[model samples]
Target chain A: MGNEYKVQVNHLTKKFGNLLVLDDISFHVKENEFLCIVGPTGCGKTTFLNSLSKLYDITAGEILINGMPVDLKKHNVAYIFQEYSNMPWLTIRQNVEFGLRIKHRPEAEIREQTDYFLDMVGLTKFQDYYPDQLSASMLQRAAIARAFAVKPELLLMDEPYGQLDIELRFRLEDELIRLWREVGTTVIFITHNIEEAVYLSNRILVLTNKPTKIKEEIHNDLPRPRNIADPAFVELRRKVTDLIKWW
Target chain B: MNQNKNGTKDNKKYILMSICSVLVFLFIWELVTDVLGIFKSTMLPSPVKVFGTFIDKFTNTKPDGATIQVHTLASLKVALSGYLIGVGIGVPLGIAMAWFRKVDCFVTPLFDLLRPVPGIAWLPVLIVFFGIGLLSKAMVIFLSAFIACVINSYSGIKNTRMVHLWVGQTFGATRSQLLFKVAIPTALPMIFTGLKVALGASWNALIAAELLASTKGLGFMINQARGIYRPDIILVGMIAVGITGAILGYLIELLQKLVMKRGWRQ
Candidate 1:
């Protein structure tokens, strides 16, 4: 059986009491695919990611990884949230190693992965600093480092750079692309920024507003080291913005 | 490392000011009782007189039937016994109650009942049950410390950020792992706060219990001195309590620093 997709969502429905948030949404993410979910504000994008990560129980449907039901114990999934959930008590290096340590990786592997990710994120110098002591960009990088260090089968990012300035966001988006290429892990990134989705994703999933459903799936075939000012990039961004634009 | 060079200099200045303030206070105390002789020696002894009695306490146990060291050691024994036991049980129980519903259901009712009743109010009952020896006094201290520790620790674990726990869960951490690795470390500051609060409560409760009904402790020494009209001995006992409490607080800070340094690396 050829399981070409890494993640499969079958009729993913979620409701809060009587209010339906994700309305029988279904999607697929291919192996090592950088899929971005973009929508208007309050469009249940976060709820979709939470359901995929199993952070919230689904009201009805099922989420699958490698064609099997999403079994958390059997498969490792890493997440980078908007809040940058680095443990305050841990240093940057320790925070990077948090998931690896929780998974009980070997000491040598923990040290190796921690150092590699820390260096890749350009945070080796600040590895000894706590999360509170670092800048907003640095904290987000530390979170990315922590998520990548685990070598997860799938990674979910919920607008991880939403709080950063534009410059920091661009720099981090490049680092995220470098990480995605190097590790080749399946990623489902949620954001409302049309440019960001066009810039980072190999495939973009556009979602609608309340009673949210898939609005469009934009496949981005731009060349690597993407130039956002490039006409094709601008064209794709305009297309995605048109798909989910409420205002 | 959190402090800068300017911060270090400011800290030194603050230390100097603190020293000067204490000296000024001592001078004023000496002025009224010794230099001006405004108060009788029996009413409010001079600093010199208190110092003399503090020295005399080592060699002479005439007034309180025990040396200052002996009284301090006895008080320490009762206070620390209750303090360690209270914190040991209270912290884990609090964390458990917050993390697990079964534990919360079992302990919260008794906790609510005991929290309102002051530790001093239990002295008569404890004294009647266990007598005025170390057991009853320790029990009195236990109630005070336990309530303080439980309240702080419970809040500490309860207040762990939801996002942090989600991070752990997304990584497939077991409940125990989440509690220990994420929740407890996140709760470190408040748990230490619980420890400090419990220490203060235990100290105060021990003294009250000893003052009401005990033969040998700093509180008993002060009470005996008051009966015998030895103001100097009373002053020594009071100073002893203050200094000891400060030292215990410093020790807790030392423990906090060790835990909070973020050096427990993989």
Candidate 2:
């Protein structure tokens, strides 16, 4: 009751034409916590994130942000959708500045914020290049920059790097952890990859098949800047992997 | 962009075919005139005689101030007026229909019924309503252009990417803001296609109307020339129509290209 929780999902439920997707799922995140959600294909990990972002309406239960309700009109929530919605017409710089433009931020402030994020994502040089001209990984990096530029209290990313190759994906994951630490924003990232979840998250939320309920909350007691080669980290990864496989 | 060597070769082949086609057409025309000798010289003048007569008609203006330029301008004015009016009405209606399902449901059946009846088919009714004047001819062109614009605009907006709409909503854009800023910009390219098609159809319909009912347009001049057994004037009128249509089409293409340079052209 000390108001420690930054986001609270209380018994959230969702249905698509009587096929229940999320069944009374509940979770809580401390402020600035990197919470990774892992599940099988069609398992409603995205559905839960979408409900929190108000992209999809919950059938039942409540989602709260900062002790207040998750009202899309009022809350400062940014989403990185799985499908690349990066405006093809806009350059990388312009795409990063999009949220600021929508909020009507001052020109100087928008420019500083956008430039900082572009540099952070290592895409400052490609600022003038359009999305169609960039590779899939570069495009995803731009999307991350855009979401972080707005400086939202909550960042929702749905499979942001699942489309990239293994090497690029690992590099971007490292960049993401760095950015998350620097920004201190509560991130609810949804992914199906077990190794990525184990590598990036402080705590992992595993969801079961459709009518998805929280199967386990595996807190990675492994220290920060986690070493993937460490025996403990590998054990946790295998545990989460089996939980997902048999579920 | 890669060099289209195969396409370039195709283009060269087409150029040769077109030249051969022109020569063959001329040879066939000459044979018909020389060998058959079916029609009198007054009724169907040879292509050689037609060219000479065309030059004479231009070189020697009428005693009155009327010339070929007058007919060309008159037809252009009617086509422009009809085309503009069609664009004005069709574009907004299309947007509304695509955005609002209730409106689409109410309007679609009516449009479908009317669309199948070509602009030329409406000639008898249009002439009865408006008489054999500029207004009737313009009305026919308007009808032809309007349907194309509406369907183009409707499909353009309707086919907007769902992810794009989600992006706008996530950024806190209101419904009206999304429609004007996102949907319209995304739908613009398809709408341009509609406009180009509509423009061509309107031009064709305008000439058809003038030929059927008018007194001063290029089409009417050609019809009159046929009655007077002056094939040269008819050929000249045909050339004038073709040149003018080509010019208008080229200008529209230029405008589209310029707009496309801007990101919003899509």
Candidate 3:
């Protein structure tokens, strides 16, 4: 609980050729904190997340994890892509075990970890099923299960539920929050949905359109077992929505 | 519902009718040739005689007056050997070119320069260097099939999604691991597509090689029939080539399905 300041970003700037994607962005993610970033479409939220994970080189900035530089070779980071990220050739169980296998964990440990996550995500019955055989919600669940099973120090997701419908999205969102709570891993989630951002995040960071800079930061002080119908939840959604809508 | 079912049944009936129509045309061909007696037997043998010759040759141990099994086995050997060599070289080269920008730039112009010349056009040069033997025939096939495979394999790897790469990178995969596990697996469907096209090209090249220079093979058999003025034998050879090519292609399709069944859904 005390390690909540696990990730710190200072003056991060990223550019692609002549175009600037992120401008002077700075943020801190407390350990075990669910930090959600919301911006208008193409506001460079994804790029910012990528920069934090070192998927993209920052034009100017520094990111620290646990009081040290974020070295990809040393620290473990997992990204849950927006769409079906599981390889079609691998089954549900195998997909969940892919990262562990790549990291060359022992066979016994891999099997036990895979089985545990498959059950955690309610996909134990479909362990042998391929990505194409699963429904969209189920595939997302499998992907999330895969990312979490790696036990990453920091989990980065790029609109993981952006493609899903309202009902499935919310259900998966619930599962995600549950997983985050149980694992207590630092999370940085990116989305354009104001409600989803407010619903899942303990803190929200809003950014302006491309050549983007942070527009606002809001702390969601809502208690656990958060009710979407609560006034505070509605107010937070409204504030985030207004920031993007007016921009 | 009944009308839709009936419509599908009628579609099948239509196809059957179309086939019968072709048979009827052949029947008229036989009748006209018989009644008119317009051509000599040497010029255009009757369909009955050609078919009879085909059956006698195919079924009997010594009907065609030549050792067809020897010819067939020779041709198969040339085709399979050339095809295997081509795939072995082309698959890796293609993947390398696509994966590395420097390699692609270096090799693109060379391949482009060599690709336009058909395999047959190289026959004279090959004959001069290797003579009219198995090596020359295999060379023709290798040249024809290699280009097709390289292009397909290159495109397959080139088009791999960055998301998959990022997925691997974020998971702490080394450069080699990412290339082999993510890029190669993702590119497999296209690689098979290339192999299928290359195989078809290999068959085309075989005939071209045999036509130019060969001691024994189906291509040589067909060329020999042409020189001896035996139209029936020519027809048999033609049928043999067509049937064998189709059968080989079918087998390749089955093999592709079997080897790739795990990832077939994508």
- CA-only RMSD, every prediction: 2.5, 3.1, 3.1
> Order of candidates by TM-score, top first?
1, 3, 2
Q: Chain B, candidate 1: TM? A: 0.93
After the best TM-score superposition of candidate 3, give how far the Cα of residue B224 lies from its true spot, in angstroms: 1.5
lDDT of 2 at A186: 90
Q: Each candidate's DockQ score against the native complex?
A: 0.52, 0.48, 0.61
Q: Which 10 residues in a row give candidate 2 chain B its minimum summed lDDT?
A: B57-66
TM-score to native of every candidate shown: 0.95, 0.90, 0.91
Cα lDDT of model 1 by residue, B1-266, tens digit: 65698899999999999999999999999999889999999999999989999999988988778899999999999999999888888898888888999989998898888799998899998888899999999888888888888898899899899999999999999999999998898777888899998899999998888889999999999999999999899889999999999999999889887777753222
Ranking by DockQ: 3, 1, 2
TM-score of chain A of each: 0.97, 0.97, 0.95
lDDT for A108 (candidate 1): 99
Give a tens-digit lDDT track for model 2, residues B1-266.
24698889889999999999999987777667756876566766667776776666665554223477877888899999999999999998899999988999999889989988898788899889989987888888889999999999999999888877776677776778678867887788888888899999998998888888887878888888877767667777887889899999999999889886445443
lDDT value for model 2: 0.85
Candidate 1 regions exceeding 4 Å error are B1-16, B262-266
Model 2 ranges off by over 4 Å = A1-3, B1-48, B53-65, B262-266
Best by TM-score: 1
Distance from true position, residue B220, model 1, in Å? 1.0
- Estimate, for each residue in A25-139, the C-alpha lDDT of model 1 and write its tens digit: 9888899999999999999889989988889999999888988988776788999999968887888998999999889999999999999999999999999888878888999
Highest lDDT among the candidates is held by which one?
1
